[model samples]
Target: MQTVKNFSDAELITAIKTGTNIDNAVGFIYRSYYRMLENFVLTNSGNEMDAEDIIQEVLVVFIDIVQTQRYRNEASVRSFLYTLTRNLWISELRKRNSDSKRNGFFEASREKEEEDVSDFLIYKEAQVLIVELFERMGEKCKQILTLFYYENLSMKEILKQTSYENEQVLRNRKYKCLKELTDIIQQSPTIINNVKSALQRSK
Candidate 1:
């Protein structure tokens, strides 16, 4: 196990591959890349939890690739990690936009420099989708879902905040709202395809 001060990317990868435990590698990956990955995801309209999940997923992918002998190290580990993160985020944004029926939000033009325009566009589009999706949901349903998922609030906290009559009521409403969102996602072909591709890639 490599500590924070001495851990390098190679050492971390080795720990991930052969070590009985990989906490050290996980910590090294988090310490080294968390900030950059967080900035990239948050800049692209994801919240804190989204950034956390994506970064963790990136590490999972790195380990998977290494174990499968698919990581050739053609590029620096940092470059490969960044590219994977970028692609995943782009796929997520595409799903969100397609789910919301907002196709023209992203421009097709390319810039000479590696501009972060797509990040900004994704955030903007996400905000729009969030608003539209919540609007489609009733106020009570929207508030319940947002508190539970987005704010990470407990159901007890939500009941107190929203003055829901009981736990059963809150749970029922949350389930229905989530079902609606799931149905909406299922109806979107692009989102369904992206979900399928993501699952396949993971396997």
Candidate 2:
């Protein structure tokens, strides 16, 4: 029987990027990271099926990251994959909670912390209106964007606050939140005008 070759981060990434023994590269990742990643999901309010799904999804994304030249060598491939897996599972938790509470979560969140996360975009009546829009999102997003726009923290700082395992993971979360917020603002004429008016006043 043949065996999957062990690869250092550099070697594995090179193989993936250069299309050398791509199958073996994948096999190495599965053998190396699947149990670790799957354990993360299993311990984090997920079932076996959920763990399997998350690990599979993480591998696909990790491979895509390599293929696209987006893999940064700052962290080991294992560490990066673990961070990716953990972040993804965290996101999946948010998603599952949001889905389960879709009917009332927004209103409930508002009731819990309507006054908190104030000065969300920046302090002002206009920003208050903006804050209201942010309130419609999930709690994780609210925390992430607030740290980003309000506290003006770097990704590393935000990771410390949010417990994100990697800067890239936090960056990805922030991007999605911003995109969602942008979509919401675009759909609202009142918010669009208020944002413009606020900028005009600030300038």
Candidate 3:
């Protein structure tokens, strides 16, 4: 196998920002960080697949931060990357613990250091709740809402993809679906509490 090229902190940041040499930079990042992060997750009650998924998600967030010039040079890129990945994994653990509690399973205790990740964990919890509530919506509502909001499709584009008779009808359906989702969210005490907690943490 060919050796993947390595990148220094400056080199990697430059490549990511300029959108050039990105493939090699990303390859280097994965090769360099994967094993360490994988070992961390595996030791912390997660499996290899969980480590892979968490790394992928954290990489996406890292890339976005780099692209948007939001990455401060306060720390080395590797350290920053590892911190983000660790925080994300901790949030995942907290979410899983919450699920286990709901199922009457034994919940694991978290470390004091993990409490620092509560803001992110709360945000992630609210996000999961929204997704769950969205899935509980009617199939038609799900489709139209996804096409319009998540997919960022225009009304005309949605009409083409869907079997809607006209843009107006699709618009009406979208409004109703949104209202339904909003009502469902409003009625969900768990979601309400999570959102409130997230907001308070943000403040």
Candidate 4:
């Protein structure tokens, strides 16, 4: 069996709050709480990958909590970590469940009054279709469109995030992606009708 090192709760909290020996603190967390978190996720419909991702995010949230003075000794560090893991896993599960439920909602919702601008079905359908379209696109196209349209990242900022050789190439790629996406939307009568209906309702 491999030996895992441990850190006292107070010592760990102090290191994170003061931003000192942070790497060691993170390592300690992985070494100590990893199995407990992994088991919790495994039993909760989460896979190994999910466990890994949750562990990474939990550490980030934990550090933030400690640094922001949210850790006021109200709970033991182990308990806090366990709580964070449970909440995060539950949130992930909810998002998955909602996505499953959304398909039914989208299909059933068209019967509602289109004149109501706030009709949940039409708006949600449009948004969901946009996501579906993006998923069908190439990775670079999806990235460019997402950064520009959704994230509102500037060309220069996107350049930093992407491996494009220059701004012109990046912009050109974005344009092509946009054009492709637009063509797709136009080809889909269902998407087009829903979007137009939503727009008309809003106007």
TM-score of predicted structure 4: 0.48
Task: Report the C-alpha lDDT of model 3 over 93-163, residue by residue, as the tens digit.
Answer: 54444454233212445444334334444454345555676798999988886765455465567789888
Which portions of model 4 show Cα errors greater than 4 Å?
1-5, 98-203
Choose 1 or 4, whichever is better by lDDT: 4
TM-score ranking of the models: 3, 4, 2, 1
Candidate 4's displacement at residue 74, Å, is 1.3
lDDT winner: 3
lDDT of 1 by residue, 145-193 (tens): 6775456465567889887798667766665665576555445766545
Task: Kindly indicate the candidate among 1 and 4 with the higher TM-score.
Answer: 4
Residue 200 CA error for candidate 4 (Å)?
A: 42
TM-score of each: 0.47, 0.48, 0.51, 0.48
Backbone atom clashes (below 3 Å) for every candidate: 0, 0, 0, 0
Write model 2 residue lDDT over 38-121, tens digit each, in one string: 887776667786676567656655664565444657667777777666655545555444455234323333321223222221
In terms of TM-score, the best-performing candidate is 3
* Model 3 misplaced regions, further than 4 Å: 1-3, 98-203
